[model samples]
Target: MKSSTFKYSMLTVGIAASLGIVSTANAAESAAASTPTIDNVATATYKIGAIAQTPVQSNKVTVNITQSAAFSLTAKNDDGNATDDYNRSAIVTPKGRVAFNHTLTNSGNVEDTYTLSLAQGGTIPGSTQDASSYDLAATNVTYTVYNADGTVKKATTVTGTDFQNTNIVLKPNEHADILISAKTVGNVGGNSQNLTLSAASTFFTNSDTTKATLTNINNSITKVPVFKITSKVSSTLNLNDPSSKVTYTITVRNDETASYAANANNIIVFNGLPEGLRLADQPNLSVSNNATIVPGNEGKGSSSADDSVRVTLLNLEPGQEATITFDVQKDQNETLTNPKNVINHASVSLDLGENQVIYDSTDGTDPKQNTNVFYPAGDDSEVTDGTTNTTTGSDSAAPLVANQRALSIVSPTKKEIPTSTTESTQVTHSVILSNTGKEVEGDKPGEVKFTITPNANNKVTVVTGSVELIYDADNNPNTPNAVYTITRDVNGDNDLSTAVPKNGAPPWTGMAPNSIVTITYKVESNKAVIDTTETTTVSLVLGGQDVPTLGERIAKNTTTVKGLKLVKEQALNENCAASTTLTFTQADVAASPGNCIVYKITAFNDFSNADARFTFNDLVINDTTARFNNKAQVLTTSTSPAFTIRLAEVADANVLPTDNTYGATASSTAVSGTVTNLAPQKYAAMVFAVKINPDGTTTP
Candidate 1:
């Protein structure tokens, strides 16, 4: 065998762009991880006498790559564009929704997965306001992952049910687009909230400082809103339904919120125009990118009911939005004469076309749900003439809620107080009312009435005239010397009701919208008895005689009297140090050998409870479980049985010096006493004591 030496070139090993970067084609093909074997051998060619023989080869050599994990995330809007708010901000009203977009790439050498999470509230890195406060347990949110071209898809959504098992797998510098759709919780017309979305590398956590969602919602009026169609008063407020004209626009969006999309055949819009209002202009249908609307189902006024307008929409793809526009005028035949608010809202129904798949209805936002302060009879206040409610139904937008009147309760319904049986005892209760409409409630004679019904045991009356007013007026923080006066209701039927605000007091017809009115009343204990309750029923109605019923409520104030009490206290005799005097002090003291432990039991009745009336009769006291039997002084000086028990009583609590009721069955083990007739504001007492044996052992 002959060998020939040939000059060879030196070789170097390295990746194109450091690791799993785009510059390398085999970046994603590196499947061999921290496990086993890639072998390489060197081959040489040799020639002898100008003739090349077989090539020579060397032994095998192996190389390895250590696993590395790292990632990067960027935020964008729905259009995949960054915004002025760090590319992560949006503004919305109640019942509305907003989406936060993000792109994540596994900028590492290996295929990896990361855990995804969404949090309700937390301040972002660049927010001026504190973290938004969440309400209503409404934590419904969703996220969709898609390839760069929006073609490759693994799952439809990552919901709360399966979010734990959901993951995004990427190799090397591969990336995926994440769309997080945050739904508004609920009827929060005047409130806002914030959220944070986060992700953590599942297997390898060496790079953890690369995660946190921080989008501020400081400018979003609709911080939270309901889903579907939203309606707004496009025209003016307080127009005569019979003669006045107004316009409204209904916005409908097709958001594929369900786990999967169901192919449907029908999408019809039905609007029951409010009373006293008639359809004037035929609805104009408009569709957004890729949406199709069919204008054939227009049923304006031809139907039996006043629901004048009915329009049909067709083929609304997910993420597409459609709108319905129309006009309405007051009906000449309407009977409502005085100024009253009228609401015009609509609904939409969908048919899945499948057998027995019941139709789904989406009701528009009602004024009751808006809950924002509303002006009546066309308010010209500075509140921008016409207001909008951000909530809408998925199928139909809830037009604005408008009615002549309605009120809400802001305080808890139940109230209680401790009772007293003293005849002529006085108790006071304060009931506050808030006017929800834009009128000054209770300014008229019968606008607001309270039916105060009392039993024979008590008398209820309103607190009126110059009462001692304790208020914080001196800028001294709640200290009061100023006399604030309130009004009185003097009706002959034993019913105290509010009149016009004649004096500078309450019930003064000055209650503004969303303002509170407080009415204070007193309950006189006429013949109240012990263990008895005083329940006074109070009924309220907030509507004028000119207008119909607006709102009504009933409340109850009750209290029950308590009975007798018992107390037992003990003091040490300190080895009988004061035996000659036998004076005892109810205080802390240590006992030595042969020290006597004095025990006093007293039965008492509260003065404010029964004052001068009720009495506790034939009361008996029993003593058991007294564990001092062995330690008590039974034998005097450790010699003979001198088990003598002594008793003493207060003179006033006894009928005579030897009264049976005042005497107790006193013993070294236990003691008890009784009271024949324990009158109100009076007490009875019995005293007894025990002594410890000097030798630290119980004397037999």
Candidate 2:
């Protein structure tokens, strides 16, 4: 059987080789095969037999990628907007139009539509720290967008609510130029506004916003046409005199820049005359550059009042000045009692159809007024002589005789007399009596007398011997030598008992105009008068009669007499005695580098009428050998006055010391302060220690 199987396998192999197929007969023969065995199988597999087997295959998937919608926008100044970067802020007049040119650029990847808006009074983004932001209303503005070639793309006016609704489409990396026109609705200055431009993509709803500020330049640059009016009087003005004629050369100069020439119009110059002056005749008006002049109103019964003059002038170009000459007459009137009434001021105004711009010399914001006061020249007194009157005979003429006299009293030596000592001290005051009125010739030379009265609270003792009388050499050179007498009421009974007279006269007699009399006297005061300000009233008598117009003159002064003492001491040992005469030599300082020295400052307000504050200085250690140990200068004790005492070290040689070494070459330390509110009869003291240096060459 094996031989028969081998022959069959061989025969099958031969047949497979001829048919290109291989058989497993030999492997089956080698294995033990008792019978056809079939085991239980959980699953079954089926393989398709085919002429050819196809390889595993797959279908490839493709996709296209793109960028998400993203964009940004920015605003910049256009080329024609401003030549200089500093010109970003402009000055515009009221009711005037101003334009701001800007470029809106799309700085992002995608095309975007940018919306325009404005913001005011908020934190400005992309601005310098602490920088002032622009502020304005968007309702009064109009704008126009331009294409790259400068052609207008859109023009519209926006309201407050719809200002931010305007939009412009921009391609990626493209920009649009724009001009924003604004009109000033009212008078505003120092105002600022911001223009905000934002861009957003259609795919992306989110938008980015940018800001640019618009500043209104300072008023000095943007002010209306500046017109300066100056006037010059032809002759001096005399108070209460109608004969004098004043020709006023009024110069009106246009000082604004040429850019403001467009706003110039037929300027109406109006000047209102003050009281006591009237228009004399027609004004001589002329303009520079041949500007036409049309008479508006002149003289009485015209559109303008008799006291005011008005004229119409052609447009005045920048740097052009006009001159208007008008004459004014002063009529007879009562003399002014106040000195301020002796001069007057005039105001000028310019009417520019819609706006009345005023240039005030006094207040810049108001109108153009007189920058200087016009004063009355020459002798303006109406008085002639006592008991006599003179008049011009005209109804408007004032009486020649004055109703009152003018006298003035002034102190020359000291305006304030300070009482600094307890002992009875003399305070000398020198005074001058002058007549500041018009000249008067009397039947007999006028007699001018002065009586001085002292305060009742003061112990008045006048130094009769010091009384003197002299003439004012500058004003009254020809006047006779002054004769005066000073009488004091020794008992304060207001009587002329004790009299002292100059060498020539009993009283100031035969005095002339603009004459002056000098008197010097001394008074003695005691502790009873401490802290009491005394006023000495002086009465004047002219021609043996009390001068009603020459009112009484009073002089006031104060006195303070308090005692403060500073004592110094030095000792080789710890124990020391303070003395005012304590002295240290250079040899002593060289011997002991750390010697102990003491200073005792005592303040006593023994007779002070009021609370006192005292200051002491130059409490120093003088050592030429070496510098004193500043840190060792310690406060030893503060007692007495029963008040707080603050002590501090000061620099060297600064205080004005009582000792002769204050301005000397010696090295010294100083200190100063106030012992505030020291009561009468109270005392305070402070003691400090100082260490001398062996070598006085260092400071600490």
Candidate 3:
């Protein structure tokens, strides 16, 4: 273990650095040990020519390319390119094939030469990637190749079963070309494809053989398309009048930002309209776009580009709007006053390109929507004029009827006198009024104010009676003249008396046209009549004024001059001597309905007390000139004095004319028997004697 010091210099350092590693080189130069000078030195050794196994890792390459045209064409190539490692990686080449020898020999027997013929029929590859076929025949032997998998990759020929000394002839080989082309139709991805060639045969050495015919096969290529649509509409619509037209605007926009290359064809539609409200077919609609519209886009043809259709849309696409206008007319004959509140079917719709889109048909802006829109005009139409009929109750007080203009008296022609101390009058009246204008159910009746005009010397007095009114016209504000008094009929068994008010309104007040009212009374003369001469004073009144005289009346003296007379006579028993003639003359010539006059006559008895009682004769004579003479006879007798007789009724032939037969009846009776030669106007006579003397012995 001796240590030696080594010298180091700059020059030595430069030389050593230039030599790259001096220390390592010197260590390899000398390794000598004293014992046998065997070097026990570390030597770096490598197995340069040593038989050693080293694993060689294979490198694989992959590409993520889509099935492009170039990739598909490479996959369709039949023969691979020998220059490229990927195409010619494992190519099979034949240097030469072993030939089979066939011979036929015979030692003795016929000294002739035998000839053998071999037939070769086979398929050969037209290109490196195509399949081949081969068939060989020698003498009585034959061979064939069958591809069970249907793809043939290699060429093969079979020899006969045996070979002998024979001259053989063989047929020529055959070649054919195969076609391999690629096209893409759809999306493709993932791993490369391996094309395989298969073979099968019954007379071959092997059953079948397969080789990778092709690799990295690509799929067909194509392009796809997409579409989008949007729709919008106006915010407000006005359907104020059913007869007025309404309009709406709807716009649909079709957009394309999709990966697909195809253009879009679109349809727009809407639905849900109120009942009876709908759009007219072939509606006015227009469509536009950024590009010039094709004929199909303008609804010219059935291509996908067709854009517009005459229809309403139930649903709208986003951002698209439509406006539709239509005219409406309301039913004028509707009976309901508020028919506008009723809803009807109305809709705006679009027929979109896609048949799957849905639409709405509900109404939104109808004119009948608000109460103010359906206000009514005033019109009161009626069928007939209104009238009032009054059926008065027994205990009811007088009623007031409005709008009366006339009156009617129910009682017959009458006059009043002061004959009795107290007398009452009862009257009834019925009044009717026709409406001159439009009549309402609760309208007030017109007012009727009946005023009696008294005589000029005295005030008009209310005698009695009241009127019944059907309607309260007196207090009605609707009528200008509302108060009326109608005299109504009174009911009673005995004579019913109604007091006439001295100061109240008249019963026949406010009478209308054709209206009637009456006043009746029991009148008596205050003084006795002298010789049937009676007179009193009364004043008739109307409309608060006294009625003037009608015509000249007959004087009291003139009535007296037309004296009472007997116009006819009838005969009793004709027993009176020289029958007195019955005379006749006109009585007070008073006017009657038939213009006839009444008459009075006095009959006298002239017969004195004689042996036979006087018999007065009475007779009836048809002729006015005929007198009661001896033709008169006795009929009956009476004891009382002669009474007045009523003669025939008479009429002034020239002035008081009447029907020929007078409307009258006549009768008479006689008194007790007392005298003979009775007046011709009287009847029958008889005599009787005292009955006292017969009891004494002498009967007279």
Best candidate according to TM-score = 2
Ranking by lDDT: 1, 2, 3
Per-residue C-alpha lDDT of model 2 across residues 529-575, encoded as one tens digit per residue: 32345655554445534443332253333333223222222323232
Error of 1 at 113 (Å): 71
Please identify which of the two predictions, 1 or 2, would achieve the higher TM-score against the true structure. Answer: 2
lDDT of 2: 0.37
Candidate 1 per-residue lDDT over residues 1-700, each given as its tens digit: 0000011111111352345332111111221232122222223222212222223332332211112233545455532222222233355434445555656556565666766655556453544333333331333334444554555545455543344435667766666666655555441333435554455554344322222221222222232211255454443445534345556666554443421222223466555665555655454444443435443323333333243555564445543446666666555455333334444554545543211122223331332222121111121111111232222223322234454443432231222222332323345655445555555555555666555555553533223332222222223444432223444345522112333333353333344565554444565432234346566555665456434222325455564443444444455555454333443333223355566655544555433433443455554554432344444453232323232222233444321122334565654443555555655556665555456665434553
List ranges where model 3 is wrong by over 4 Å: 1-231, 243-247, 254-262, 265-276, 280-283, 289-700
C-alpha lDDT score of every prediction, in listed order:
0.41, 0.37, 0.21
Per-candidate TM equals 0.27, 0.32, 0.16
* Top lDDT model: 1
